[model samples]
Target chain A: MQKNKLIAGVSAGGLALLSSPAFAQSIDETVNHLFASATGWFVNFIFSPFPGTSFPWIVAWLVVAATVFTFYFTFIQFRAFKHSISLVKGDYSDPNDAGEVSHFQALATALSGTVGLGNIAGVAVAVGIGGPGATFWMILAGLMGMASKFTECTLGVKYRNEYADGTVSGGPMYYLTKGFAERGLPGGRFLAILFSIFCILGALGGGNMFQANQAHQQISGILGDFPGWITGVVFALVVFAVIVGGLKSIAKVTEKVVPFMGVMYVGAAIIILLVNADQIGWAFGQIFAGAFTGLGVAGGMVGALIQGFKRAAFSNEAGVGSAAIAHSAVRTKEPITEGFVSLLEPFIDTVVICTMTALVIIITGQLSIDPATGNYLTEGGRIVTVTGASGVGLTSAAFESAFSWFPYVLAIAVILFAFSTMISWSYYGLKAWTYLFGEGKTTEVVFKVIFCIFVVIGAAANLGPVIDFSDAAIFAMAVVNITGLYCLMPIVKRELTSYLARLESGEIKKFK
Target chain B: MATKYIVACDGSSASGRAIKVAVEQAKLNGASLLLVHVLEWSPYSFLTPEELEERHKRRNEELKRAQLALVDPLVESLSSEGVESSAIIRYGHVSETIADIAEKEGAAQIFVGRTGQSTLTKLIFGSVAASLAQIAPVPCTIVP
Candidate 1:
């Protein structure tokens, strides 16, 4: 259904561009118009601030959800941290178990979904606009967000549809509908449908377009300027090959390559931090002070808090419920185990990796600050002052200050990050698509083709609308998911209570 | 008393030779044959969520295929030779699972074909025969 809306918008742009004699000159405008107009109302609605405040209600929605879940579960993210690690280590796993995937595999699959441009580009945006203090808020939100993951993922597994054929299907759609009906609650099906719609949009906007747009931005930083559509078309074809052509071996190769790239990216960040070891203390100081006082950055402490929480939610996706889809596939009788495993995602993506990126930007002196006023030099492009370098470009500049060839390496990483993210999101969106439209080859192909088209459109469209819609769609998911979670969280808490009791009584023994 | 002999099959000619040898031993001793086939699998693997979702289905399919192609024919042939036989198919590390089955079944001895893997392959991945020799509870014979 959403695909039809997208097709109408795209064909409108196609018609406009085809009618124009200068196709190259008008393509950007037309694509931007189509994307912005189609998604603008939804974006404005999702991000519309609470009352008169500058803070987007969507950001507050996620923040409040995470905070509440943290308390409601009595800080399960912290309590289960050690146990979660053990579960991931396979301590309780039996060799003769009939499960399909290990806890580690489930966590890794979900991590690859969450940790992408949000760590690199999104961090740079946070620090560039919100100052170093955003780093502190980002970490705080990441920690709290872990609880949200625990609740949602637990419900995801408990309510998932396990078929006799040994395949399982789950996510917000399944849990919201099934759990609601089981509880005799109204609107479960409605909310489930609504969540699926937002999920599909989120998958396309944040998962597909935002990634392609950023990948193009980084590639263009080194490769000189060209029409983004060319890059978009190339990306779309490669993605089409994997998702539609049934070349799962390519997906397998990417599954291997992406983790290696993630490690290399983190290794580079660590090396940069070590080299700038002396400034680490000062950078932390900036982060702490800016978090409270805003360090004369725009919008003061409130701006920092908003950007920190917003980007953290976007980065880790703790409350948005997408990770629950991936986590539900684990081979475990205890639904709580996957929940425990999932809490590590926000910590890794936000607290650890996002902080590394923020520290690099701050330590590498990317944000131009005036010594006398102790304010960001906002006169002439002070934030990310390396002349038009923002997002991945800003991150690339920071890393390049440490290594001359880093940009070249970064371009490769960004593209791989983008491609892998696109592939993962395709599956996510397909799940949502199948939920709404019913699962069939044709329905599946229809969604896949629309997803590929958006890849091109995302790459070609301007960043402003693409990011706005991406943030909106993702947050929209949080609204429905968290509302459903509030009703169903007690169920998760019961499961956790029972599981822990069993563990303490030695009813559940560790095999290793 | 009737005894038991275990033969590991991979459908290769080497395994066919091992089956023949195990059959001869089983018939001479009035023993039954237990034909085992272990499909190599590890809990540790990097998979996409979609692949993970379908993994159980694929595992079932592979198990069924191995049962049909590797174990059933051998079980029928052993029966025709006047040796009682049964088959078990599983998924795990080949040598380890074979050793485990041997221990569990209390077999007198075990038989496996010498794999045609290259020296470097054997060095890198470890030969199944070499692993069985180290881990099997009973005496193990490798049919070349």
Candidate 2:
């Protein structure tokens, strides 16, 4: 509720850096000289052509696609929301179906892909830039994004190819090529190739590297700075083990870990919020008030919306189509049921987890605001940006406010999140690689080994260009995926209609 | 036959003992032994068409492998010792499948292993031995 909650009460670690002028100044100068110019231009280029604003049009592209899908599906995300939950609970799944995993396992695996460091760091970054008001828009984006997830994942299952060996491969590449061919479309092959390339890049960069980097940041903050290579090497090794074991192992771990970690994270957040119960109402007021008026942010309402939309896109990755890969593994004869299952992903990842992170940051009062123009003071530097350390550190600080040793807990959670994301992405990238390279033991191992190597590079390298490339690669995937979605949406719609009819007729029995 | 006995084997020592017991029972009753092994297979029930086909294919392979590795060897050993024996392998829930085979074969009794799961593990995931004992259409014995 206080206006000047910033510049003061940084967590113990944050406070130490902020209080020491010599250390902070030197680090700031070095970081600025090293990365600011490079990142600034790269960011501007990616986000350029937003007409009146420098806002990343890719964010707008994602939001608009979500909105369109929501309207096109006649709010399927809303109407089928209950069915979606039940589908994830495996009510309609027929064990006789031809897939490797259950509906719930597929949902959990996809969720692990979507609910990574993005839920942790991405939310704090949104709130850091957009203030508390961003939470509203973030939830909005998540809700709409569900429909896009539905469309893509349905296509994923419908068009997935099963090798003679019993393993299945899916995602946008399968759908774009196979679906388009069914429709006699011209660009199916071309689009499929394009999507595969981007997906591979995205898998390595955002999926593996960025996760490693953020996990490194969180761990180093708690454990004291060790060489980033150590975190990378360990992550690389663990990721290798799970991935080399095969999709079943990844599915097994994700189904258990994602739910447990989600509960633990949200449980901790709920406890913290309950402890600060007095500020609960006040925090909502701030979120609402800041959302429309921009809370005196630099770009006003536009900035808040941009940050919320951008971070939500980055977090849940609804239209980005990576989730389709994970979801396609579901053992459902009805592909649409997996679609129903996937729609819950963004809801859980962004609407639930991301919002929790934001609320924690807001309620714990970690954001540093300027009293003059009511503008939040964001200190930009090398790796750790923002004056009070926004992103995961801000989230960490918020939790640290409640318990002195909570940073350690946050570190463990981050590593787990990072680990799960990497494993899921390994599957995604492998599918994409095999799409281009053809499926075999050798090709799959090649993709996996490359993925693990990037984990090390991501942890060890300075983040600036790596994050830029990762972000660009991810956006590149979204570009290709959304294009294919627009082309194949009619088929998705038909599937949706038939599924609803079957559901109503009780053709799809509820085994649960 | 004077009497027929079904012995379920899972390549475990308890099941081996059960096989021995079934042999002894068949010998005493001047009957025959139906040596059977059920591979535990429960589909998640959500596979795509291709995966489902593969699962069914794998199920057949598993049944064949079990018959070769488990039931065939046990049946051969029994025949060598002058216990009239036949072998079959199936894939399904362990207890139910065993019951089904015994019913279909018109066996007079059933013998099963009592190992593979501790009480706590059994509580978490249903114990096949306990379930078989409860649901067996014929007289059932659990050999430890």
Candidate 3:
């Protein structure tokens, strides 16, 4: 007990010292020095071949890759948006269909998993660091992302397994194995196993820990120094309850919750934009200027574009194939129906919701730079900002400046969004886990328990490096997933042509 | 005194035709007709208990009035032809209520129309129909 008290006393003293103006300034200086050194190292690595080569250049390369993919797929994302809406509405239900849930429910479940922090925090980070111009590139990246979603989800349904009892299992694992096996590849199973492992890791990190940490931060920020352990415990309990009930339960909850939370949050942002009415034009000007002129942030035009594209890619997760796992369980025989619905993900996420966040941040003028040093400042101290989480707080503050009670509303929305996301992602990770490990009830339950525990850990721990790592893990998964989609494009084209033929022939009628 | 059959009518033209077919089949088999129409629980499930009860009662009356309108015409026609028929109004999910009424009425068969008010095509053969088909105690037919 004496030792514990002494440690506590020492920590409090350290904190007090850290909070002093002199100490804080010194800390800032130290951080700047460290950042400079790190930036130098990164610059050297990136520019080894040429002095001007940088990380943003690599990001530009990724954007080109995504853009090329979008074109190669014949701009299917734009052409299929309306059809995607109809698909979700289940306008073409066949009696002999062989799946578990409606297309809308599948999209809802998948959206619930993908639409969380990415829309709220991810957008903010893109606009915050990348400048307003990032929004333009982000939207473009999201458009390309749609084709990726279409390819992956179609493959998810096409390669799904129907068990003896009529339950279904699918996703990248199934396609990598079954699709590749059909091509007479000797190592199809091995590749599938590897994909599943990556998916599980990606799910656990990006899907579970990242979500929980942000949720915990938001709750703790509102509640004011509430023990991290308490937040973790509550989050774990709620997550355990829903996930234990399995995918159907998760789907049911997400179907209801995703729509409600989405409308509420988006509606709030719309209200803010309306209130700011006249400044809307100026905000757009800043975004476009910051995007092209590269006058705002340190990274220049290329840096800004990369930040925007990276954030959007991270947000919608179109190419990742994780969302396809959720969509695969949808009850329908037509793989194309779910694929169509899956395309709406990036639209709602990056285009609509992310745009709203960018508007709020930009219109409020809270993200403006200091004229003397060209550094950004908020609340009068050198802005101690991490990308996603800090961006969400900036948005909340903007709303609070406009409407006094909006902070509370934003907090509630964040919790609901985060909670729904965590639950849906638990299913995604578990499927991947089951695909690689043995599929037993016990195995699933154990995974749920571990996932829930991470919620607490994520909520409590310092997550700056952790979330970065998690985001990287998710991007890595996208690399593999998009590769598979590229290779399997021919199959998607075949399915699309066949389905469109049937539609044209009137063999499938619209819902009466 | 052959086995009775329950046929549900929802007041649509298709439902009317379905009832006619069901009654003709029942008459041919020497079975009685027990026509039923179910009034669903309200969409506003988040209301207060008193409000809910009032809503439920009002819905019940509406259903009763509709059922009587359907049954009177059929009864008059049947009685003139020296045939027997009866009708009922119940409150619940359409499929579940139909299954329950069938068991209680000792029905040997059940009949339904193909579509309902909700334009959701997927749901027509979805959970409700799937459940009834799997667990209904009698054979069921859906007339398009």
Which residue pairs collide, candidate 1? A133-A291
Off by over 4 Å in 3: A1-52, A56-65, A95-100, A245-255, A370-389, B1-6, B9-144
Q: Which candidate's lDDT is highest?
A: 1
Error of 3 at A258 (Å): 3.7
Question: Estimated TM-score per prediction?
Answer: 0.93, 0.80, 0.71
- Ranking of all candidate structures by their DockQ, best first: 1, 2, 3
Q: Looking at candidate 2, what TM-score does chain B attain?
A: 0.88
What's the distance in Å from true for residue B2, model 3? 18
Instruction: Output the TM-score of candidate 1.
Output: 0.93
Candidate achieving higher TM-score, 2 or 3: 2
Q: Give lDDT tens digits, candidate 2, residues A1-512.
A: 11122112213324555787444323323332333343456456666756876577888889889999999999998899898877766566553341235666566556767787888888887887788888989999999999999999999989988767555678899899899999988898898899899889889888988899899888888778776666877988877877775445544654556567778889999999999999999898888888898776657677788888888888888899898887766546788888888898889899889988989888887876576866556444111223357567888888888888888878877887887777667777887898999978998888888888778767765665666767777888888899999999999899888978987898877866
Per residue, candidate 3 scores C-alpha lDDT tens digits across A206-281 of 7776777677667766888554545767878877877775434544554566578788888888998998899999
lDDT of each: 0.87, 0.77, 0.68
Q: Give the C-alpha miss distance for residue A440 in model 3, angstroms.
A: 0.4
lDDT for each residue of candidate 1 in A1-512, tens digit (9 for 90 to 100) = 54576567567657866787456645666677777887888888888888978988888788899999999989999999999999888898876763357888888889888889999999988888888999999999999999999999999888888889888888999999999999999999999999999999999999999999999898787888877877899999989999999888888887888889889989999999998899999999999999999887778899889889989999999989899888877767889998999999999999999999999989988888888988776543235365557778888999999998998988888888788888878888899999999989999999999899889999989988998999998988999999999999989989989999999999999987
Better of 1 and 3 by TM-score: 1
Q: Count the backbone clashes (under 3 Å) in each candidate.
A: 1, 14, 3
Q: In model 1, which regions exceed 4 Å deviation?
A: A1-23, A379-382, A386-388, B1-6, B23-33, B82-85, B100-110, B133-140
